[model samples]
Target: MGVQVWTWILVGITFAIYFGIAIWARAGSTKDFYVAGGGVSPLANGLATAADWMSAASFISMAGIISFSGYDGSVYLMGWTGGYVLLALLLAPYLRKFGKFTVPDFIGDRYYSNTARTVAVICALIVSFTYVAGQMRGVGIVFSQFLQVDITLGVIIGMAVVLVFAFLGGMKGITYTQVAQYCVLIFAFMVPAIFISFQMTGSPIPQIGMGGKVEDGAYLLDKLDQLHTQLGFKAYTSGSKSTWDVFAITLALMVGTAGLPHVIVRFFTVPKVKDARKSAGLALLFIAILYTTAPAIAVFSRTNLIETVSNTAYKNMPQWFRNWENTGLIAWTDKNNDGKIQYVNGAALEGKTPMFLSERGEHGQRVISNSSTGPNELYVDRDIMVLANPEIAKLPDWVIALVAAGGLAAALSTAAGLLLVISTSVSHDLIKKQLRPDISDKAELKIARISIVVAIIVAGIFGIYPPGFVAAVVALAFGLAAASFFPAIILGIFDKRMNKEGAVAGMVVGTVLMLFYMVRFKTGLVGVLDPLPESEWWFGTSPEGFGTVAMLVNVVIAVVISRVTPAPPASVQDIVENIRIPSGAGQASTH
Candidate 1:
């Protein structure tokens, strides 16, 4: 069979497996829909959480970002993974001990304010919707590349699949399907990295292979550093960002990971607090498998890409290059009519000359005018690196097919998790708790399904018209989560004196300030506000990293408000104490 046929076959098989799990685990009640009846095993929950957390960003975009950004990309690696540590150590156990079906449930009951819960619902929707939009786009990109479908059509198909699983199975079905997804995605990610590592450095482990010597006996990191320095780019292993910016981005991601409502909700599915903690450890372990391999994949692919295109003619470019070019991700402009493509630093230092300088020196002047003449520029979309890796490395067609399926799995799993959070917040928190307390469970389930459909449509629209900065947009979502939800939840858990006034004030102020800053810098508002130079960033933190600052502001505001106002009642203090101890796990109060 041809590659396309095999790709479809693999995708079909994955859908069948997911659909089967959804049907087999079909949720029968509100409890099932909300938290999988609160009986999921630690291992299963861990796998499901891994699937939920990975998303399209992790599977498709992360390595690509790392590949282009080099050492600077480690911020993503450390930020995302480290955030999970915060979640496991500080948040998950306590939240699971509270034994609520949804995040808003914890917020509402803990704060003793329905308004607080509603605000949380709104925040969850915004964060999840923004994040899911990117996932849907990722699915579309994968489908357009592998299945030869139009991007819009791919998004629609992906949306349909997600609706079936998420709306039909709810949490119960999504959980089991996610476990399967975790398996497929991890295998797909590792197989190519392993192959490339062995081929380039004679090492089976890609992580070690990244720093290991190349066939020419030079260290890969050292060689990449040399290439980047020659090209007038920062060294591969060093960073160009200010220390404060790095710290802010890392802190934002870490808090955002801890604050993400969808990720936090996963712990509620497990049976006990201890199980939640164990699942956290397991989730990180599964995540680390891909996270560690990702850097290696980035380094390997970057090396392979530079080596292949550095001196090759456009006509000599590989099939994968041409294929990706058709996607408009890779473009070549032949400036001087030289058949050979020249890959060099577009800008070189003035006085400090290099062996290879582009037509333009450090200044905006052209230097080497296509001495040979070829494409002046090559633009390769970062998303293509991982999806096209197997083909680039000349791996088996089955491996390519597996990657397609894995990408879909990663996208769909995260979409399902996000949809569940949105739906539960709407049906359980907004509707049942506030709007219609007397509604039947069956009716609530219907409303949850309706919410899922609506959320899916909204997310699909975003996939079609993706924001200009996909990575930064996703980071912003994390930042918002960190700023608004993380502080509220952490305070609610750890601080007995925290009052509803403080929580509500913190969430509103933090969320609003973060949104304002994001809109001002990230969107068209920058033109109106007058753009701020990179050097003028607040506290030297980039807009992308401003979530940490916003979060700190939230904490400060919350503490001040709590101190000024009255503290939580003694009953609330007792409740906090009860949540801290695991011995009362079985009889834990839902409130």
Candidate 2:
């Protein structure tokens, strides 16, 4: 069967399932809209949360990044999964006990200040918006290939589908829909990994196969490291990033993952505080299924790509190679014009670089040249690794179609969750709490639905005309969350004396500082300033690593400011103590 036919069939089936879930799980009240009636089973909530947490980046782009970054990529693995440990132990259960419908609601009530809540809402919007744009891009990439439409139209179609499900069902619908999506995406992700593992190492399990010896008796990592060095790249088993920077990036990602409002909101859907904890554990397990296999996939794909494509002539390349090259993501320049492609470290090559060209070959391949005449002759976008993996391995057409469906599932599930956060923050935290406290439940729910539509449109715009600094901004979203929300939420829980002034100041300062660092380094927002180099870094902290510094600043400032101010009132202190005790947990309260 043709790729389009298979894609349409599989994608159509998944869409039908999602739309059915949306109709069946439609919210009947504000409680249903916001927290799915707070009666979700722990097992089910875990699946839904997994779907929400594993965005397109996790399913599609992560392994690709890992493949090229080698050991340095461990930061993503440790940081993302490690954050779940903190969520399970530090945040989820206590937040569930607090029984608020959203993260901002908890901040408002906990600190006894609308200003604190407002700050939190702004942070939530920024984080969720930045993250969702990436997911939108993922959605567009899949649909653009599957439906044969331009990326802009693909994004619009994706937005329309998400609108129907989210606007109609709210959290009630999105939760159940995510459960279905989790199953689809995980299955889609694993099949290719298992196939590649068996093909390469004769073992069905990717994890064990990764370590198992192949035909030559050398372990897979050893082979990869050997090949990597031969090609002038860093050894695959060793890291290139500095230790302090890796630690800082990992720490920032961990805290940022915990601080994200969309993931935190999942706990609010469970029946009890205990269920929230149990659900976090299950979600981690579900996520780990993919996370553990990803490194294996990365090693396999990297080895295969290097062996197959490096030094091969363009005319003799495989169809999958040619197919991807047509997408403009995979490009090669005959820099030496020897008619053989050289894929090596560009920095290490000697000579002036060949000029880049807009011309195309008869095969429709881009006429690329060396960025400089280093050993480099090719540019492969890391984002294409997973999506191109099945084809790279010469897997069946149906499996490729399934991967397309999986990408959409990963992108759509997270997009819905983030949009929910955006809409709820606007309607529940900003409008209902501040502007119209006495608004009818019906009116507030209506506004929330409208907010979802508006948020989707705004998110789509960001995706379509993304900025040059989007990559940094996306990472900075987590940094911003880590720096701002993590400290405030933690201090609010553990310290009864944490006053509103301290919390507000910490959030504001942390968010602003992180933004300043990101905009200055990544964008022209600073206006023609010379690029900051590694030598100028504060204690070797890169912009990506600065979140940890900002987080510490928030903690220290909040602590110092709280000490100088009056303590929190007795009633608020009592509520804090009550939250620490897990018993008598109730459903999420709108009031």
Candidate 3:
């Protein structure tokens, strides 16, 4: 069968499995909805956690960014991996011990204030929404390209799929569903990687093949570096970002991962503190399998793309190239009217992607309506690299279909998790806790379902019209999480003297500061004014790294305010003390 037929078959089967799990394991009560009835095995939770953590960003965009940016993209690998370690060691166990299934619930009870809970809920909404946009966009990218539909239509389809399972089973459904997703996504990611690795180098293992020689017996990196210098681009192993920016982005992603409410809540699904710790460790192992392979895949895809397209006749390009071109992910402007594609480094369009013309050019390639000032004539969206890698290497139809299925699994799994967070925050944190403390579990569950549905719609909108692509948008979400929740959660746990006033003030300031910078610089829309130039960056920090500054400011503001204000009540102080007891995260009397 062809790629499209195989795509429908694989995507249909996996999605059917997800829907089946949702029906079979549907949530029975608030406990089931919130934390899978807190009975999940460590291993199961670990797999689910791995699936949840590795969103479309990890499966799709991370390597794509690395393929394009080269060594500069290593920050994502280091920061995200380091951040998981940070979460496992610094945050996850204690949060699990505290026994509030949600971050807002923890803050609300820990700080002894609904106001603080409300703030945390708002922050969670912002971060999760921002993050989910990337996941949904990833789904759209996979669907639009593989299924041959418009990206907008693709996002809508994804929204419906997520709503089915997420609405039916909540976290109970999402957990097991993620385990299946993890298997699909991981296998899909590794198979082609192995194939292309062996095809290029003698080694079948991608990690080893990355360091091995090409057919010419030249080191693979050496060949890639040679190709890069032949073009107008920097060498593949070089870094162009300032050291400060790199440090900031890495810090933001790391702490942001630690503070992400969706990831933290996974720890709550387990039965005991020991189970949480065990799951964290297992999750790291599972995560490393893909994380370690990403750089190799990046290198392979980058090298393949340059060699395949550079100076090649547009008419002679392969079927995969034309397929991607039809999706508008790639284009040719035919600068100087050359019949060959010029894949040299530079912008091929004024904007992020090519605006394609309705008609084809002289070489019968997709004509871009927009043109660039530079010499480069081709426009290839980086997000397409991982998806197109298998096709570029001429892998079988089944492998490409599996990749599409895996992309969906990765995207939908995380989308379900994030939508659940949005629902839990609204129904449990905002409505049940604040608006109607007397609301019944049935009503809250109903509300949570409604919240998930509504959240899915909003996510679809963001996917249809994103501020940026997957990694960039996800990084901003991390920045928001780091700035707002990291200090509040860490301080609330460690600082017995920390009060509600300080926590609330810190969260608000940090979130607002990060938002201001992101709007002014990243998104470029603050009350209709132009985005500030790079020269106006705060102390030369990019928006992605600015979260570290916001997080520090949050810590300082939280500390200074807590010193001047009255200390937390004796009962609250005692809760903090009990959480620190290394023996185990005991039952939360607060819960």
Candidate 4:
């Protein structure tokens, strides 16, 4: 079968499995919706957690970012992997021991104030919505490139699929379905990597193949370094970012992972503190499988892209080039009228992405109105690198189709998790806990389902008109989580003296500050205006790194306010003490 046919078959089969799981495990009560009745075994939770953690950013965009950024991209690998460790070690078990359904649940009950809970809820919404935008956009990219749909139509289809599962199964359905998704996604990612590895380096293992020699008897890295410098780009293994900026971005991603409400709530599904710890360990192992392979994939894909397209004639370009051009993710213009693609180290267009003209050139290549005056005439969106790699390498139709399915799985799994967080925050945190304390379980469940519908609509809009690349947008979400939730959650648990006033003040200021930086710099108000240049970066730190500064500011404000204000009540202090105690953790009051 052809690539599209195989894509339809694989995607159809995988999606069917997800839908079946959603119906089979559909939530019957508020408990099932919130945390799968808090009876999930550690192994199941581990697979679900791994699936939840490795989103579209990890599966679709992480390697893509590395492909473009080279050594500067190592920060993503270090920061994300390290952050999971920080969260698993410092937060997950304690949060699970507290027996709360969500992060806001813990904050509200612990801080002894609905106001503080309200702040956490708002922060969670901002973070989850921002993160889910990337997932939905990933879905759109896969559909546009592989399934040959318009990006808008693709996002709408993605929204419908997510809403069905999230509305039906809630956490119960999401968890079990994610296990199946993890299997599909990992297999999809690895098969391509292994094939490309053996094709180039005669090794089946991508990690080793990255370091091994090619047919020319030269090491892969050495050949890539030669290719990079020859093309006016920096050495592939050398770093270009300032040391402090790298540190700040890394720290931001690390803490952001720890504070993400969707990821943290995974622990709440487990029955005991020990189960949370066990799942955390198991999740780390599973996540490493992809994380470790990402850098190698980045190297292989980057090498192949440059060798295949650089200085290649438009007419002679591979079939994959024209296919991607139809999606507008990759474009070329006959700059200098040379009829050749110049994939050098400069922007190919005046804007971030290409603006394709309605007309075709003499050589039948799509014309781009936004072509720049620079020597480079090729525009390739970074998000397409991973999806296009298998095709670029001339892999089998089944392999390419599998990648499309995997990208969708990676995206949908995380989208379902994030939408669930958004819904539960509104229903469980705002409605049940704060608004209508007497609301029955049935009504709360219905409200939760409704909330998912609304949140997915908003998320679909963001996906349709995204502010940045998948990983870049996701990085901003991490920064927001770091600035807003990290300090409050950490101090609330560790500093029993921390009071509502302190946590509330810290959350408000940190979130606002992070928002200010992101708006001024990263998003440009969803294209209402142009973003400020890198020259205007604050203290040489990019928006992704500003979260570290904001987080520090939050810590200072929280600590200072806590010291001046009255200590948390004796009962609140004791609740903290009991949660930290290992022996009684399983028996602690969930209220």
Candidate 5:
């Protein structure tokens, strides 16, 4: 079958399943809408959480990053997975015992102040919206490739589909849909890895295949290292990042992962505090399946890509190369006019353009003098690696279609999860809790729906325009969460004397410092000053790793302020004690 027909059939089937799940699991009460009535089994909730947590970045882009960055990219794998351990041990069970509907709900009640809650809500909105933009962009990429539409139109279609599920079922519908998504995405991710592994290393297991000897009796890693050295790239097994930066980035990612409101809220949907802990454990296992295999897939795809394209004639370039080139992600200008593509490490050579657009001359031949320099000629968007793996390996058309469906599932599930948090924070926390405390559940639910619509529209706009800020916002979201929310939430649970004043100061200071660094160094939002480079950074920290410093600052500031201030009220202390024990902890109440 053709790519188009296969894609439509597979994607159509998945969409039908999602819509069916939405209809069958529709929410009636605000409780159902927010926490699925707190009746979900641990296993089911774990699967749903895995789907909710693994966004398009995890599914489509992670391995490609590992492929290119080599050992440096291991930061993502270690950081993301390590955070789950913290969540399961320190936060999930206690939060489930607190029995609140949202993260801000816990913050507000714990501090006995609406101001603290409002600050938390602001942080949640910032993180969730920033994260959602990436998901929407992933959705657009998948749709543009599969449906043969413009990226803008694809984003619109993705927005509409998300609206249907989020608008109809809220959390109740979203949870079940995510369960289905987990199944589809995992299947899509694994099949190609297994196939490619067997083809290359004679091992059915991808992890072993990555380290196993190939047909030439050489270890895959050894071969990759040799190839990288010959091509002027860093060794595949060695990294160039400083040790402190890696440590800082990994810690930031771990804390940020645990702190993200959308992820923490998943624990609330289960029946008991114990179940919440079990769900986190199970979710980690489900996520690990992909995490461990990603590096293997990276090795396979990187090797294949290099051997296939490097020093090959342009006329002999594979169909996948041309297909991606049409997307403007991959371009070659034949810098030497030899009609051959030279894929090299452009960063190794200063003031050299790797890829450029060649202007046509009178004879319609490529003219190098008129070429325009931008991104490297050999550039490849990391997101395309997973999506194009099956095609590049010449797998069946159905397999390619299945990969497309899986990518969409990953993006949509996480996007819907984020949109839910953004909506609930507004309707439940901001409007109902603070503004209209006496609002009816019916009215609150209406407001929630309206909030979702607005959130989706805004997310779509960010995806369509995709500013430079939007491109790096996922890192920003993680850093912001690490700085602003993680310490407060952690301290609030463990420390009875953590006053509202201290928590608020920590959050505000942490958020402000993190944003200042990102805007000045990363975003260039303030043009008055040039951003500092790595050598000039404080403690040699990159903006990506600055969150660790910000987090530590928040913790120290909070401790100092709390010591000088009066302790929390006795009732608040009692609530903290009650949550820790979890003896009589009940289901999260809608009220």
Candidate 6:
């Protein structure tokens, strides 16, 4: 069968499976909708959480970023994976021990203030919506490219899929669906990577192939280092970033990962605190499988890309080149009319005379076009690397189809999880707790489904009109979560003296600071901080790394303000004490 036929077949099978699971696991009560009746096994919850956390950002964009950025991209790999350590050690077990249905519930009860809870609800909504918009956009991108549908229609289809499962089954349905998604996405990601690894290094293991010797008798890392240095770029294994920026970015991601409402809420599905801790460990193992393979894929794809295009004539380029160019991902312009493509570090031209582009090389520059007078320029979008990998590696058409399915699986699983959090926060925290205390469980469940539908519509609209690149939006979401939620939750758990006033003030200040910096640096709000000139960065840290500083500001402000204010009431302190001890896990009640 043709690739399109196989793609449709795979998609049809996936849809049928997900819908069947949704019907079989339909939630009948508010508790089931909110937390899967609070009886999920650790291993199952871990698999579900892995599926929910990976998202399109991990499966699609991460390897691409690493491919282009080289060693600098390691920060993302380390930061994202390392954050789980913090989550397992400091956050998950305590939150699970607290036995709350929502993150806001813990804040409200622990602080003994409804104001604190309301603030958390608002923060959760902001972070979840911002993050979900990117996931929805990813789903649309995958559908548009592989399914041959318009982006808007793709987004609507994706929304329908999420709503069918999430609205009917809630957490109960979403959990099992995510488990299946995890299997599909992992298999899809690994197959092409393993094939490419063997083709490049005669090793079937991707992680080892990353640093292994190439077929040409050169170490892979050494060759990458040589290529980077020749192109006036940094080495592939080391970085030139400032220590403070690294520290800050790492810290921000750690806190943000722990504070993500969707991720944290997954722990609530497990029956006990011990299960939560065990589930966290399992979740990390699942995530590590992709995390370890991703760097290998990055290195392999980068090497393949550079080697394939470096000296080849534009007319003789592979079909994959034209295919990606049609997607607007790779473009070529000839300057000296030599008909060959030239790829180099654009940043190397800064502060130095453009001898290559402005003049001719010793070998005489090759220009593929008569319209330009300089050397040829190559532009490759990072987003295309992973999606185009199978074609580049000459893998089977079925593998490409599987990748498309995997991309959708990653996006849909996370979208369902985020939607559940958004719905529960609305129906349980806002409606049941604040709006209508007398609301019945049936009424709450109905409202949860309605909220899921509404959330899907909002997310779909944003998906069609995504604000920026996928990774950039994801970083912003993490920054917001780190600034607003991490401080409150950490202080609430560890410090007995942290008060509602301190937590609220810290979150507001941190969130505002992060927004201001991101707008100024990333979105061009200020003329003084334009994209040109390497000196434009604040302390040489990119906007993506600014979240770390924001997180610190939050922690410091919260601590300082807490000292100035009265401590929490004795009852609140007792609740904190109870949460710290695991023995009373069964007795800890959700509001």
Candidates sorted on lDDT, descending: 4, 3, 2, 5, 1, 6
Tell me the lDDT of model 4 at 488: 90
Q: How does model 2 fare in lDDT?
A: 0.87
The Cα error of candidate 5 at residue 294, in Å, is 0.5
Cα-lDDT of candidate 1: 0.85
Compared with the true structure, all predictions reach lDDT values of: 0.85, 0.87, 0.94, 0.94, 0.86, 0.83
Q: Candidate 3 residues 376-418, lDDT tens each?
A: 9988877888899999999999999999999999999999999
Q: In model 2, which range of ten residues has the least summed lDDT? A: 347-356
Q: How many steric overlaps are in each model, in order?
A: 13, 2, 0, 0, 3, 3
Worst 10 residues of 6 by lDDT: 347-356
Please provide, for model 1 over 7-75, each residue's C-alpha lDDT reduced to its tens digit, 9 standing for 90 to 100.
999999999999999899999999999899999999999999999999888988899889888878889
Report the Cα RMSD per candidate. 5.9, 4.1, 2.8, 2.7, 4.1, 5.4
lDDT of 5 at 295: 96
The reply for model 6, stretches above 4 Å from the true place, is 335-337, 347-376, 524-534, 584-591
Pairing residues by index, what is the TM-score of model 1?
Answer: 0.92
Tens-digit lDDT track for model 4 on 487-582? 998998898899999999999999999999998887786537777989999899999899999999999999999899999999999989888887
Q: Which stretches of candidate 5 lie above 4 Å from their native place? A: 347-376, 467-472, 526-532, 582-591
TM-score of 5: 0.94
How would you encode candidate 6's per-residue C-alpha lDDT over 96-179 as one tens digit per residue? 988888898888788787788888888888888988988988888778777777778989999999999998899999999999
Give the better candidate number (1 or 4) by lDDT.
4
Better of 3 and 5 by TM-score: 3
Candidate 5, run of 10 with poorest lDDT: 347-356
